[model samples]
Target: MTNENRFNFNDALLTALFGTPSRKNTIDRLGIVCPVFPDEELRKSAVILCERIKKMDDFSWTALCKMAK
Candidate 1:
């Protein structure tokens, strides 16, 4: 996919995986006004996130976001 498309996909995926956090909580915890994927660091972070998610027992959004970071 194109870079734009990939970024869009990643954003959607993260939103779905993490649900929609309360606006204030999200900003405080993640420092993101909206859901986003790591771009320049995608290669390294994606691999780690995927592996961590796969091993998670609960498969929760919070878990996924933690892993993604």
Candidate 2:
């Protein structure tokens, strides 16, 4: 598949962290900032996301998109 169509772990983490791509308003509505949580809190969140990333090889574009919500 072309790079544009690829869905990887990094993309999932970003979506989970930053919310939907190119939907700044939605993110704003959700109150998700770059550092949504404090560093210590974020590290705890990262642990959960890391487990998710390890369990899945990749995700469909639609699945990644849902991560935004």
Candidate 3:
């Protein structure tokens, strides 16, 4: 998929976790304002979790996300 069509975390994750984008300023204030990785513990945990999830087959990942909701 192209970048626009790809399931970007900015598009999917934010919408899933926080809802939709609704900013009109210089900053595209969309979704929950998640902090970037300076917060080491959270960042590390997320990275590890993502790595684990990434290892799952496509069907499993899709199911996991579906069930998570």
What clash count goes with each model?
Answer: 0, 0, 0
TM per candidate: 0.30, 0.34, 0.44
Judging by lDDT, tell me the better candidate of 1 and 3. 1
lDDT for model 1, please. Answer: 0.42
lDDT score of residue 39 within candidate 3:
61
User: How do the residues 10-30 of candidate 1 rate in per-residue lDDT, one tens digit apiece?
Assistant: 544544544333333432333
| CA lDDT of every candidate | 0.42, 0.46, 0.40
Best by TM-score: 3
Worst ten in a row by lDDT for model 3? 23-32
Clash list (residue pairs), candidate 3: none
For model 2 the local lDDT of residue 3 reads 62
Output the TM-score of candidate 3.
0.44
lDDT of 2 by residue, 1-69 (tens): 556334456445655655443343334423444345556655454444434444443343336557545
lDDT of 2 at 17: 56
> What's the lDDT for residue 56 in model 2?
44
